[model samples]
Target chain A: MLNNSITAAMADIATAVKRYSLVGMLGWQDVRQRYRRSAVGPFWLTISMGVMIGTIGLVFGQIFNSPMKEFLPFLAAGMILWSFISTCVLEGCSSLIAAESIIKQLPIPLFVHILRTIWRNTLILAHNIVIFPLVLLAVQKPLGLEALWSIPGFALLVLNLAWISLILSLLCARYRDLPQIIASVLQIAFYLTPIMWLPSLLPGRAGTYLLDLNPIYHLLQIVRAPLLGQDVSTVSWCVAGGMALFGWCIAIIIYGLYKRRIAYWL
Target chain B: MACIEFNNACVDFPIYNASARSLKKRLIQVATGGKISSNEQGRVIVRALEDLTFSLNDGDRVGLLGHNGAGKSTLLRLLSGVYAPSAGTASISGEVASLIDISLGIDPEASGRENIFMRGILLGMTKSDIAEKLEEIIEFSELGDFIDMPVRTYSSGMHLRLAFAVSTTIRPEILIMDEWLSVGDEGFKHKAEARMNELVEATSILVIASHSRDLVLHTCNRVIWLEHGKIKMDSDPETVTRAYFGH
Candidate 1:
């Protein structure tokens, strides 16, 4: 009986999903909803990143004796990757809670909420991509066919984010304070990560370990490394791949155990 | 083609103390050798539906009558595949359209035209399907100039008119409705009711829950009276309604 019901539910979800080009529209809606009624729309994200990069590059480059041209592109890449990582973790915290209305009322697939979160953040990430071109052109940075690798790099980032969003959603639904803790932890991670500071600049063993322990740093490495036309390390792929597997495995377990109770939880 | 069967369905929910949003509080209580009394925990296990079993064939106009929390909504949720039963199985065939919490998927900040896509997506309609029905939904809603306005700016009537129009546009094999609440003004009510009546005619199977005896008598040929998460009486509408009213 349970098997039959599970199969039926799966079929229903498939049908619901097939009816709409959910990926296409959901991504658009997520972007539009966030920037609604705003003058610049998503360009605001690009503009702000641009301003931060310019200020930090000019002021800090002079202080650190690093060339402003080299520092500007680095800063732009850092800011964009930081935004992507922060958005994935922060939004993962409320992926379920934010959709409480739909969750409580409709019988749609729970995964749709996670998809919505990833798609929403992906939109911002796309906008942030605009800065790379501007920075590259301004700095006269090396750009070639290797830069196109960012497309696949970002695809991996999004896939990994999907796993993270799903697992975090299940956890936050069970634990209310998780979202706040996650948000606070992400704030700390931003500093721990080599966002404003270069990794080589970190003094010693302790700092290197801290950088190594932080997953967001690796995520940024995969993205920024490819965008900078550098070869991505195997370490980045291994860490991201491991986290994705671990997250998705745990999510499936939790989903299987509590799939029946999720509705009542809402 | 629309057939629905529920067999000894049960839904069991855990009773977690969500009031204090911290594990430390719960852990402290646990370490202190059960600070929270067992009686307090009984308030947590909610059996929304228990051992429910039923089947409906095509063209079954079944009205479900129950007081709030009597498993009426749970039954509808189960039938609609929203909430799976904790035990037993529900075998359903054909397309199901549930009208539970009408206007649920509409975004308040989006225009009526945008909401058409939002609500339609939630209701399992493709983008092309929403586009196809856009004109008919707009016409039936009669919100002429206001269709382009944000839903937040719409009156309660306008909200219902558009929601009902969009929801009823697709004729599902099974149409399930929770108690239809009032959405708009008097004239709007007439138009909405007419649309609902047409929807009823178009659907092959209809399930509704309401407290109103008149509504049950008028719209349903069969009725099930539920009490305390159990079926109190199940029979023809006139018979059950009469028994319920004690007339």
Candidate 2:
């Protein structure tokens, strides 16, 4: 039954987390290794964010004819969220391939590898978060403990990301080329998902419905809205919660059916 | 020292064709095979272990002598809990250190120092335990300055040294090895043999899957000769080895 599969998957996840602390370390190492031997380390992420927000704000502000003051903060917030979401989806697609050696050698929980991918990206996300506060302080924008709400908002984003990572890792493992396909699709998704510009600026009636229907768009809204001190919509909450549950269900079923075959597949 | 049991253990591997791994291809093969000839399934399911039952008690140094593809590695995997049996139980009472593949989990990109930690942890060594034996492991491996260099840069000999050092350091109650003794060079082999002897003396039970008759006689008092996934002979090393080799 569907209920039984969910229960089995939950049990597998718990077992995996307990058995593989190294998986978390592996994820952390990936992030460290990426920027290691470089002069600035993960500050590269922060630097990249600064460049993006500044360039996009200056260029797009004039094009959209929006005020510079309003546009810069909006662009900064949008860029930060886009970076978080894009990293989760992109790195997640390769989570399994990168951990192939570990998977073959030891039968630790597969989900641990997925968690490693998400956690590592979250670390980079932390470095990027530093830019938001510094920019706010420079502008003399009001920043308060209420900004802490973004913590829970970010946590939800992670939970959803973990679910996606699990499903994608399993899929790509079975089909060697799926990771590349997912990468190309993610590029397309960036333009579609309201990352670079506001969905409000889009021409129109049906486009709003498409944006509203996207769980990713809602996920970004949930976290981005709270971080930017905008009102959180009930619709966004329902969509995010719904996607979280649904994504987990799908991840679990795929993992349960395919977990045993993974060793052979490798 | 504890009891190890594999009760009615069975392992079924779902075999796929070499060309492509897809449902459509498999279906086409099945459909065509049925029309062309016999065994219409077109796919094969291999039973690596079938209703195998055995138990080993404390202080039993058992050698598994079998031809290649005779399910020796599969049996060791079941013992190590790497592959769970499909039909039955593989139960062990105490901590087991499996040298099934001596270099199984070493990260190639990591340095010798980092691999020492990774291998140590995979062998179930605690952080402090690894710390306690760090100097000794590095010294025995003779990897002096190479210890800090990445493993990808190490020669095969150096890689084997690091793997052998980490695995042999941990003395488990039950040790399972699958042709892992032959890791390093001639000089290192002597050192490895001595370490294996020490582990054999210290451990309560040791299961070795090897084709070497000399190794079987020297390391194990008991030997089990397996053929076609069944135990053909199980007795004293002298008796089983003679029967296995038919000499």
Candidate 3:
């Protein structure tokens, strides 16, 4: 029975992944639903983000004494990736709960809801992503072929986010208070994850290692470093990859044990 | 080939309030081996369905009759594969279309046509399948000019009509329904019931949970009467309805 449940859990994920088109359609609908009334529609995702980056870049560039050309592009990329990761984690908490009616009435795999959340945020990330290149063009920065590495880096980043979101969705559904705690934790993590500041500004070698220990820091570097035409540390890639593997394994086990109980819990 | 099987299947609802759902309290209990939250075992379990073991085959139209909280809806959910049993096993081997809440994923802000696509996919229809039937669904709903308009703009009757059309458009090997189709005015209700009968006839197995004694007696070959999460009587419709409705 134990082994059977595990197999079912794995099968459920496999089934949902194969129906990626369904997830894509639902995800697009979610994006459309949120900005339905606005004239710019979903493009507000890019405009609002541009305004925030412009304001923060101006103030923070002056405070850190970093050049606007360099700092703005850096902050833009970091904020884009960080927001994607954060919302994937935050909204994933309600992925199942928000679809309570569908989950109750339909027999679709539970994993499909998590994938929908991730796919929805991925669409938002695509919108916010426009800012990075525009900022780079504004500053007239040339990118090397090393930037192509960001492809694999971003893939790894999304894979890692998926597992973490899966865990949070399951736990949060059972524990009503978890979303509050998760929101607080993410709020704190934003300030600590080096999105607005440079790692070099930290005190010393101790600072780099501390950042190394933060998985979010490693996840950011793997994608950001490559996009910035810099070399991402092997340590960052390894950490991000390892987190994806182990996190998925743990997520599968937890899902296997509790997925059947999900309906009852709700 | 479609079959429904349940062996000692039981569904227990874990009733946990805000306090019991705290991870901090759960962690404390784990560490100290002592209760940190209220209630027995820090949770109350409501056994929604108990020891339900039965087998349904092709051509067996089963109707569930029960009072409120008597587990009719829970049994329908179990049959449709929404809620897996907490203990024992329940397996459904067929494509299941549970019309419990056909408007489950309909977005009010979306146009009537888009909501059709949304509800269609939610009922497990592929995009191409929905595309092929799109005209039929729209025509049946009779919201011609309003089809492109946002569902939020539609009146309450119009909204329900759209949902009913899109929901019934789905045809599955195993069909599950909460009640007889009764939507819109007398005119639309006639169309809805005709389409529902067509769907019921096409399915290999039918499971309808309803309070209407006459409808069950007319539509179902077999009836299962549940009382407080257990079967009170399960036999032919004529016999079960006679006992259940005191006819």
Rank candidates, lDDT, best first. 3, 1, 2
The candidate that wins on lDDT is: 3
Please rank every candidate by TM-score, starting with the best. 3, 1, 2
Off by over 4 Å in 1: A1-20, A23-27, A203-208, A211-213, B13-15, B19-21, B26-43, B180-194
Q: Which residue segments of model 2 deviate by more than 4 Å?
A: A1-11, A35-59, A130-142, B1-3, B17-20, B23-47, B86-94, B104-111, B142-146, B149-156, B180-191
* Candidate 2 lDDT over residue span A134-205, tens digit each: 777656676656666667777788889888888887776666667777788878877778766666677778
State the TM-score for model 2: 0.83
RMSD of every candidate to native, in Å, equals 3.2, 4.1, 1.8
Q: Can you write out model 3's per-residue Cα lDDT over B1-247, one digit (the tens) per residue?
A: 7999999999988877777678877888888877553457766888999999999999999999999999999888988898888898898999988888766888998899888888887777888999999999999999999999999998989999999999888778999989887789999888988988888889999999999988998999999999999999999999999998897
Model 1 has an lDDT value of 0.78
What is the docking quality class of candidate 3? high
Per-prediction fnat values?
Answer: 0.45, 0.06, 0.90
Best by TM-score: 3
Clashing pairs in 1: B157-B184
Question: CA lDDT of A157 in candidate 1?
Answer: 80
Query: In model 2, what is the error at residue B202, expressed in angstroms?
Result: 4.2
Superposed Cα deviation of residue A169, candidate 3 (Å): 0.6
lDDT of 1 by residue, A1-266 (tens): 45554564455335534543664566688788778899999999888888888888888878777775667777788888888877887787788778887776666777777776777787788887798888899888877788777777777787788767766877777777788888888888888887777676667986768767778877778778777777888888888778777765565555556666667666
Q: Model 2 over residues B1-247: C-alpha lDDT tens digits?
A: 5889889888877665554455445457677765522453544778787777888999999999989878888887777666777778788887777776778667776789888887887666667788889999999999999999888899998898899888889888888887647567888888888887887788898999988888888888898887888778889999998988887
